[model samples]
Target: MCGIVGAVAQRNIVPILLEGLKRLEYRGYDSCGVAVNNGGLKRARSVSRVAELERQVDDSGFAGNTGIAHTRWATHGVPATNNAHPHFSARDGEQRIGLVHNGIIENYEEIRTELKALGYVFESQTDTEAIAHLVNHMYDGDLLSTVQKAVKRLHGAFAIAVFAKDEPQRIVGARLGCPLIVGLCDNENFLASDAMALAGSTDQIIYLEEGDVVDVRLDGVRIYDRDDQPVERRVQTVQAYSGAIELGPYRHYMQKEIFEQPRAISDTLEGVLGFAPDLFGPKAQDVFADIDSVLILACGTSYYSGMTAKYWLESLANLPTSVEIASEYRYRKPAVNPKALVVVISQSGETADTLAALKYAKELGHRHSLSICNVGTSAMVRETELSYLTRAGAEIGVASTKAFTTQLTALFLLTATLAKMRGKLDAEAEAFYLKSLRHLPTALQSVLALEPHIIAWSEAFARKENALFLGRGLHYPIALEGALKLKEISYIHAEAYPAGELKHGPLALVTEEMPVVTVAPNDTLIEKLKSNMQEVRARGGQLYVFADGDSQMSSSEGIHVIRLPEHYGLLSPILHVVPLQLLAYHTALARGTDVDKPRNLAKSVTVE
Candidate 1:
């Protein structure tokens, strides 16, 4: 996935383009470039960060009222200056167009062959470069018509922004499977792959649907459908704040987001004094009445959240539930229960595989669909009939922290609401659940107080090459999440197993060199989990147990313990995950690895 930003304004728009790209750099940050239509065309490309792109532009002293910029996470080409975006198309002496694109163009090779036969030569090894040449070849001095024609010939996911030197006051954009938006301002107009890029300049945004072409000018904007008819789309205001992207006094975004858990969880639980079906959406009660089972679709951290919710949905609501990795779910033609409720979880709400999986579920005759997401304007939210928005503000870290916790909070609320509707909860039981939720912010703060202890463990963990995490019941998903964090940020090879399943196979990997992180939650499975820890000890493995105060596990010869203040009952996963996040962050800090933008990972996986 890549980030694209375009601007057409009465004043110079170079600053706006650069700042917008800076905000959207979390989507992709391998290389970046910007093209400006200043009388002729002026461009600067970089093989490094956005700051380097800005410096290159400054050193060249480029300025224009119309511009398009890109920050790329390389897919078709390697990360280099020539492979950077804002690709150009010019004849021997003629300059006509420059384009920035997000998403893959599946039919580029075929088009490139035709263009090459027609006397067009390519300068870079990118699918996006072909688009610029094709648009230039089809240009009849009408940029809108040319872009519309070029998009029709292409096949695959794309959100493209194009600018012509002849038509310097206009920018044309088109979208198919990826996201694109038009930002409205007083005397200016903007386009970006994400609405978060427009938060600083304008909150008013119009989301472009699939196969919609947009023509933006300094005065206004016009939307066109696939059949060349004009269409009117409603403008919506985005609630995200620009300040959330700032990392105030923190070393990395993961650290800042980890510390923001209390506020993020509180914002997610704002108006919920008691549980009700309307907490999700107006149609939630009716949907819950007909569905006898639940099927959750998600990927990466969101999939783990779905796994955690499967536990809650089955144990609390007494409903059958299944979780599937979205990428794998979409490919296999599995048996589907028509009455099952399909729930999709995504932090960005734009993950391509998850969206495809949701579509597949709907095509298989599942009528009711719901999305648990963070972004309101994303494709998943638009496709689902009912949805719950997680209020975790802009997550800049490639490794997720607050988004996972907030998803758990929202899913827990969904569980309680479903339980109430099914008559599984009495008035006193509902009141107790509400009270526990009200106390969650304080409980989270208490867990955050254990960071010093986690940091000490991280110091020793930094020296180790591998780790094993063990848990049972609902806490098993929490252990999976912990291992994922360590591998994502710290680059430590880690594996997680249900404590009962260790004897089946994973126990063979345990040794003195392997640090075994155990989640002993003082619940019904505590005895079984403790026995698993003993299995690790008998094999000469070191133990780091996050146990409850009354579990009686302490610092012994081979056993090390950090006892929590109190056990949080059903909400223990929400509390137990904080220290693991801290462990990953501090361990990455000790190992001198890039914590925020881990290698080969982007904050949002908008491509398949």
Candidate 2:
């Protein structure tokens, strides 16, 4: 995935474009570039961070009233200056059109061959360059119509913004599968892949639908549908978190989000007097009643959350639950059940694979759908019939922290609601669960206090190249998440297994050099997990255990233990995950790796 931002303002838009790119840096940071319609087309490109590109713009004194910018996460080509966005289409040795794109062009090879036949020379090896050349070929003095025609010939997902040297003060944008928003301001209009990029500049935004093309000028904006018919879209006022985006008193966004878990869980649980079906939506009761099973569709960290929910939904609600990786769900021929509830979990809600899976489930006659998402304006929220908005503000870190915990909080509430609805939980049991949830914020605070201990462990872990995580029963998915976090941020090779499976195969990989991180909650599986730990000790493996305060496990010899403040019954997973997040953050810090923007990863996965 990449980020795109465009502006049609009378004022010099160089600063605005650069600032917008900075806000969207989480989406992409491999390379960045900007192109402006100055005297002709002035441009700056960098195969580095946006801050370096900004310095280049400042050194060159580049200024333009209309411009387009992009920050890229390398897809088609390597992260190089030649492959960066704001790609140009030249004719007669002069650049005519400049474009910034956010998705893949599947049929680019065909288009590139056709363009070469037309005597157009290509510069970069990116699929996006084909779009620029095609747009240039289709131009008939109308940039908007040309973009619309060019997109028709292209295949696969895309959201693009284009500006031409011949069309001053005019910019054209189109959205097919990726997200593109129009920010409405007085006498000036802006375009960005995400609304947060235009946070302070404008609150009013128009979310473009699929196959919609927009013509933006200093005076106004005009939109057209896929069939080339004039259409109007709703403009909503979104409260962009301009202040929360700042890293105040924190080393990185991952660390800040790791510490924000308590507050994020509290905000996500706000207004929950008690669990009820309507907490999701007005139609949730009917939908939940009709569904006999739940099929959770998600990817990456969100997929781990869904895996955690599968345990709750099956054990507490007495329902069959299945978790599928969103990217693979549609590719397989799954037995469709019309009564099954399709629950899609995503932090950004714009994750391309998850969104496609949700639509695929709907296509197979699954009527009941629910979305657990952080962004209220995201496509997943708009598409699903029932939804829970996790108030885990803007997650700037490529490795998720607050979003994961908040999703657990929401899924726990969903479990309670379903259990009560199905008569599996009585009034007294419901009250006890609610009280446990109410105590969660305080419980989370105590877990955060263990950061000092986790930081200490990270020092040892940072030197290791491999790790193994162990958990049993309901906590197994959390171990997977822990391993994912370590590998994602610290670049460590990590693996997780149900504690019993250690002896089957994973135990052979255990040795003194392999640090085994165990999630030893004080549950029914505690003794079995202890046996697993003894097995590791017998094999000369070092142990790092996150145990419950009352688990009675302590640091001795090769085994190390850091007890959590409380044994939170069914809700212990939420608390145990926080320490793992802190461990990953501190480990990344010790290893001198980028914690917020890990290598070869973007915060929001908008492309498959």
Candidate 3:
């Protein structure tokens, strides 16, 4: 998940480029660099943070009116100064081309062999270096045409920004599989992998489509389609949330986001008055009428949200459902039902594997597709026939909190809509579900009040090396999510298993040193879950349980219980997950780890 920013402007662009990279830092990166054309290609790169790169630029007196910058998440080489972005293509002892790229090149080995045979030498172990050399080799007095011809030979996904030493006032950009956007300002033009990079600088943004090439100049911009035909793209105005990116009173973005859940769910359910198929889209009524089953596709946290929805959809809507990891779904041929409604979930909507899976599903003749996402203008939204936009705002934390809850809120709405369409819900049932949804914000507030108790538990957890999470029935996915959050931010080895599955194998790993966390909602499985807890306690395993107020669970010699305010029967997963998030957050803080920007992880997985 790399980031790219480029600008053709009249003023010094180094500050703008550096600030853009800062905004994109949440996407995750290992190294950063910038290249400027001040009569010649002047570049600086570092494997350290962006702040260090800025210091190096200032010390070297680096300044330019036109430039390209990159924050790279390494895929082809090790994270080192040489592997950093803004890679160069030198000719006759002069760096002629400076290029920054996102995404991978599948046929780089073949291209590199051909380029090497043509006497082109590579200095970095990256697939992107091949593109730079190919561009330099194809330069015939025009940077735009040279890049256009070079990208035609590329075999895999890429979004690139390149500047030529001879064409100091111009920058060429192209996108195939990854995202790219153009920002418009007075006598200035910009290119970035994300519109957030140009938030304060420009409000007018143009999202480029697949296989589009853009040429940016100080006065204007030009675009070309895949077939070499000149084209015009619509420019839309975007309101930048300047205040949302700041950490106000909160220690980290993760903490602020965790506290923001109540408002996020409220915003996501803002306009809902009652259940209706049209809540999803204008065509939802027809789509719901035709579908016989549901197929959910996603990855990581989104996949877990789908797993929770499986219980909601099957039990409430009486529809058969299946959830698949998006990355694995596209690799093998599977039975595709033409009538099955395909639902894809993601927060950023730019997740590479999920987007690819959506395309693959369409190619396999799936007639109906829907996207539940936070970003309204993302590629997944554009590719699908219907979409539900979750108003979770901007999730800056690499470990998701508000986004995950907001997704569950959206999926629940979908379940209710389908239930209503199938005539399974009468007036009384509809009113009850609506009242429960309206009261979710208040319920979430009550759960947040339990943070002080969770913080006390976090101290004991921070000293441990491993954790085990258990749940039954509908809460099993919540247990998986809890384990994922613990391992993701706190860097602790954690695992989750269904309560019934513990005796099968996971119980052998239980001991006094292991902390077993359980989600005990007051559901039909409570008695069965009690038996599972007995098994854990009998094995001398320390237990930390999050139970509903009426579950009748209490703290004892080896058992530590934190009671939730109430039991939300159908929506308990959404409420049960908040404490686990807090447990992970405070644990990471106690361990002195980077809670916001965890090591080796990015907020958005834009590349496979």
The candidate that achieves the highest lDDT relative to the unseen native structure: 3
Instruction: Return model 1's CA RMSD, one decimal.
Output: 1.3
Q: If the candidates were sorted by their lDDT against the true structure, best first, what order would they fall in?
A: 3, 2, 1
What lDDT would each prediction earn against the true structure? 0.90, 0.93, 0.94
lDDT per residue (tens digit) for residues 401-449 in model 1: 9999999999999899888888888899899988888888888888889
Return the lDDT, model 2, position 509: 99
Model 1 alpha-carbon drift over 4 Å, by segment = none
TM-score of each: 0.98, 0.99, 0.99
Model 1 CA lDDT for position 2: 84
Quote the lDDT for 3 in model 1: 91
Candidate 3, 264-339: lDDT as tens digits = 9999999999988888899998999999999999999999999999999999999999999999998989899999
Clashes of each: 0, 0, 0
